[model samples]
Target: MEHSFHYLLLANQATVHRQLLAKLKDTGLTLGQPKVLDYLQDHDGANQAEIARACHIEPASLTSVLNRMEVKALVERRTQKGDRRSFAVYLTGQGHSMALRVRQAFEELEEQAFAGVSEAEREQFLAVFRRVYGNLKEGER
Candidate 1:
């Protein structure tokens, strides 16, 4: 029976994420994997650590995802030149194609989610959301 705006906002967020997961599932990717691929699409051949940071994922989690992606032949990790201990990640041809799909999936989701909502309303909502997020994050730092 929570009537607070926070409850409504959280509920909406959960629903949207669930729908996004469903959409991405069709492409054989989990929630986080597409983000990694999307980032790498723009910054190909990035190191594992860089990719993890850019994708807002932990190194261990990125390692697990990369392992799965490697098995799928979507990405390959090669030893960095002059740094045999470090690896650079590169997308295979399959991965490049999948990345395109991932981008399209995200665009479709956004379009569907915002259907019938005017641009001004969307901008105002985003402004408010960012303020709320900042307020909550203030305590963490």
Candidate 2:
């Protein structure tokens, strides 16, 4: 198969996902859970909508993910001040520990992925990827 942009993008995503899942196997987390955990580590107390947006997940999907997290005793959703209809999400102690694990997994992957790559090369790749991302986002609008 030709190494087209679409093929490379999808292949890289699948490969990375597989590696991450392997690393997180003992955690019993599924595909979307790690992303939410990672995001909530830095943005604890964010609302459902904020989490969905930041994590690029649909609101309905995020709801289910949050429900599972709640079941695992990894997170809590408290009623927001002055907004009975809205809730702010928070991490449990276990969730914080899991977040740290997730961060380490990500760092290990980054190190492996960039092994032997020059700093200048990494910067150039990031610059190009940013433009590619911007182009795709622009197409959505």
Candidate 3:
């Protein structure tokens, strides 16, 4: 009845993600919201389609997340200069600040998670993770 290594890894990831997300709730951000914020932080004024692609989220889901962020005054959506039908997304000053905090929280959480792990072990773990991710994604193609 022992779980496989992959199962344990995935379970640990899920648990950690959930725990960190709970900590972020007070910042008025969710796990998915920060992805869009982080993208916009680096590439401001991106259209929904671009944001969705970069964030690896479906357009529909991105739309919902953007809507909520807009309502919270974290993002602003404006008509594109050439295309009135297309809107560009930008993070407000508040959103930019929150993005920084969110990034810090993620770093802290990761450090806490791997507190006792050596740097060599961490790099090896990341390599294995990337390979596993590639293997799983290859099956869908």
Per-residue alpha-carbon lDDT of model 2 for 107-128, expressed as tens digits? 8998898999999999999999
lDDT score, candidate 2, position 48: 98
**Model 1, poorest ten-residue lDDT window?**
23-32
List the global CA lDDT of all models: 0.86, 0.93, 0.86
Top candidate (TM-score): 2
- Give the backbone clash total of model 2: 0
Per-residue alpha-carbon lDDT of model 3 for 1-141, expressed as tens digits? 139877887788788778778768788786679778878888889999999989889999999999999998999999998778899999899989988877777788889888999999999999998998889889988
Model 3 C-alpha RMSD vs. true structure (Å) is: 2.2
Candidate 3, poorest ten consecutive residues by summed lDDT: 1-10
Ranking by TM-score: 2, 3, 1
Collision pairs in model 2: none
Q: Report the number of clashing residue pairs per model.
A: 0, 0, 0
Could you tell me how far off, in angstroms, the CA of residue 109 lies in candidate 3 after the best superposition? 1.1
Report the C-alpha lDDT of model 1 over 1-141, residue by residue, as the tens digit: 477897987887687668777877766777678888888899889999999988878999999999999998889999999789899999999999988888887788888878999999999988998998789879778
